[model samples]
Target: MVFGANSIAFFMFAGVVARLLIMWPIGETSLKTWLFVHVFRPLFGSLNGSLLFALSFLVLSYIFMYWLYRKRIFWKV
Candidate 1:
C-alpha cells in the first residue's frame, strides 16, 4: 500500500512539473494572470485538476490502508 501510494504521488508530481514547464514560456507571471491561468487556460488547468485528484486519492488510500492494518484486517477474493 505504501508503494502504491508513493507511485501515485510520484506520477501526480511529475504531471504538475510537466505542466509548469509547458506553461513557463507563455506564462504571464502576474497575480491575476496566475489565477486566471488556471481557470481560463484549459490545458494549464486540467493538469492542475488531475494532480489534485490524484493527491486526494493517494491520501485516502493511505488512510484506508492504515486503518486496515491497525484493525488486523485483510481482504480475500
Candidate 2:
C-alpha cells in the first residue's frame, strides 16, 4: 500500500533517531577513523576525507530514503 506524506515523514524521523543511537557509541574520533579507513582514505586520499565522507553519506542516505519512500517501502511501525 502507498504511504501518506505523514507516514513517510514519520519513517524519516525514526531513521534519524535510529542513526543517532547507532552513532552514539562510536564517538567522534572513532567515527572519523572508521570512515577514513574504510571509505575516505581509499577514494579521496585527503586529510579532510572523513568530513567529506560524512557529509556525502548524509546526503546520499536522505536521497535513498526518499527514493524508498516514493516506492512505498518505508516501515510504518
What lDDT is obtained when candidate 2 is compared to the true structure? 0.62
- State the lDDT of candidate 1 residue by residue for 13-56, as single tens digits: 55665466556654547433444456444654666756664565
lDDT of each: 0.54, 0.62
TM-score of each: 0.39, 0.38
TM-score of 1: 0.39
Candidate 2: tens digits of C-alpha lDDT, residues 1-77: 22353465546755775466456545554554566677787887776786687677667656666677777665545
* Candidate 1 Cα errors over 4 Å, as ranges: 1-44
At residue 5, what lDDT does model 1 achieve?
A: 36
Over 4 Å off, model 2: 1-47
